[model samples]
Target: MARVMRDATVAATAEKIFAACGPSWLGDSYNHWSAAVKAWAVGATRSLPDDDRRAIVYKTQELDDALMAARRALEEEDDE
Candidate 1:
């Protein structure tokens, strides 16, 4: 039963995540799964426990930070 519940959760998460990826960003290698997963994490689950929400938020921040770094690096390359 626990296994079945876990599988259901995974399926639901995947569906929610799939709904998140859209309006395509420029110059991105669109991996639908990654975007969907991120969206699922930051979406309706906002009502989860503080620790869970915080973890998701932190993950989002980390991804944002990485993207900013990548963009800066690209800009520097363009300048050179």
Candidate 2:
């Protein structure tokens, strides 16, 4: 199905983005890189159908939240 394929493609792209820009304790560089990736994702998905675009946005937000949580955990560990 086209929708299934679109979902798979979005998932694959999310994985690559996460691998390349996952959270780190590097502060500004990490923030900048994450922002850049987010922008790139938006641009890349601009031509997708509405549903596909929404799926990618949701996935991206999910990944971003996970990365933020991981970063917070690392900071907590460092603080202890």
- The most accurate candidate by lDDT is 2
Which window of 10 residues has the lowest lDDT sum in candidate 1? 1-10
**Model 2: what TM-score?**
0.54
lDDT for 26 in candidate 1 is: 38
lDDT of 2: 0.60
Instruction: Give the clash count for each candidate.
Output: 1, 0
Model 2 stretches with alpha carbons more than 4 Å out: 1-4, 17-46
lDDT of 2 by residue, 1-80 (tens): 13433667887776676676664334334444446455665667355454554565566556666778887899999999
Candidate 2 lowest-lDDT run of ten = 23-32
Off by over 4 Å in 1: 1-47
Give residue 79's error in model 1 in angstroms.
0.8
* lDDT (tens digit, per residue) of candidate 1 on 3-76: 22243454444443333432223345334334445555565634444444334334434444466678889999
Highest TM-score: give the candidate number. 2
Residue-level lDDT for 65 in candidate 2: 68
